[model samples]
Target chain A: MILGLTIAIVVVALAAGALNLVLGLLGKAPNDLSLGALALVELALIAQVVTAIVAPLVGNPPSGNPIEFWAYLIAAVVIPVLAVFWALGERNRWGTVVLGIAALAIAVMVWRMQIIWTVQLA
Target chain B: MRVRASGDPLPLHYSVSVPEARSSLATGLGRVLVIVYAILALAATGRSVSQILSRFDEAPVAFTLSALAAVVYIVATIALVAKGPVWNRVAWIAIGFELVGVLVIGAISLLAPQLLGLPDINPFGRYATVWSDFGAGYLCIPLVLPVLGLLWLRSRRDAARQAATVDAEVRA
Candidate 1:
């Protein structure tokens, strides 16, 4: 996993999540700003996916279990997609909250992927 | 005497709203609940499948429990999404099972770790699956989910009944 990309996804995702949570609390639903923030996190995930494909080809292989790392990466990528669909289907503040939760989940999952990439003792 | 009902109330909207039918489980807060359940379903499925395929020999019990939890989440997610009384009942059953499963598994993992038959290679022996430790691994959301699901389902049921009562009164 690229350190820069990992840090970027984590920070952006967490920030997007906090923003959504604040929006939901303030009774705001999925607007341009909220959706745009989600798209930002989704872009980082896309970058992670691309880097995962290319980095291994360049000899910078992960030290940990590839299966575990990939599992997390895949899940991290899917959550936001699902959240977008759910948010569109229900344009309520809770829908925004769901997006926030998904963003938070992505952040945590990406962090775990990094752990599996660099620090899995097994 | 002629009776004219005010008809169904418009759904409360928070922002640019999507046009949808009124008063179903998969609306508003329930939508959030379903998304959470969907996330858990995906996570549990991925974890259980990977564990079972890779190291089922090392920890059969843990892997099996993981699979069960995955199935439960998947079922509950689908049930919550599908519209109708039947799916609602199915959701109740699935969520109720989830609550019992998490509570029982959490207690067992805490009190009697050996009962799980997990080997040392398994890092989080007792806490292997999502249900373990009442979902502490996932921030206890699993524990809170079913309780909220049941309450939401109950609330929806009451609303449906009240609507029916109003309809009956209008007709009479």
Candidate 2:
């Protein structure tokens, strides 16, 4: 994983999470901006996943537990999708809160992925 | 407390008994709880399954405890999402068990890691259970979830009881 790209994703996710939390606190439902930010974060995660998968084929397999790394990768991709689905279904401020939590989790997951990648490289 | 008029025709498929007001487990804040529990359940299941399948022989006791924690999390997640009195009771039991399990496992892992076959010369040494080191791996969410779950369940039960009482008074 490229360090710069990983950091960017984490920053975006955290910002989105904070925004969602504020919206939830203000009794506002998840609006376009919140969803859009999440979409960007999701796209970044997809890019990370692609990079991780392709790097291994290029003889740069993660030095750490590959299975665990892959599990986290897959889970990171799934979290936002599930959160958006639940958020749309809920149609309330709490739905936004759930999205906030999802974004926060994604940020953490990305950080973990970066750690795993660095461990392998080192 | 107005009653239906006698002249008004009932639905053709109306049941003989009145259905109690449905109390859903996934409403408002409960929805957030459900999501949190579901995430934990997924995480625990993934971790335990991977450990057990890859190297069960290395630390059987710790892996088995991890599996047990996964099971408890899964049950609690399901119970928290399903509606009805039966499911409510199941949620209470599952959440209660989760609290007890986390406390016991946390204490054991911290004070007596050797008791659970700790210090194994494996990639993921001893403390493998979800409650190990108070869920240090997952940022202590496992340690805190059950307490929140129990409080949520209690409040919901009280609300349901209050609603039932009001309904009874209206009928009388």
Q: Give me the candidate number with maximum lDDT.
A: 1
Give candidate 2 regions above 4 Å deviation.
A120-122, B1-21, B120-127
Q: Return the number of clashes found in candidate 2.
A: 0
RMSD (CA, Å), candidate 2 to true, equals 5.0
Candidate 2 pairs with clashing backbones: none
Candidate 2 lDDT over B22-83, as tens digits, reads 45577788878887887777667777776777668977998898889889988988887775
Residue pairs with clashing backbones, model 1: none
TM-score of candidate 2 relative to the true fold: 0.87
DockQ per candidate, 2 decimals: 0.49, 0.38
CAPRI-style quality class for the chain A–B interface of candidate 1: acceptable
Model 1, total clashes: 0
Docking class of 2: acceptable
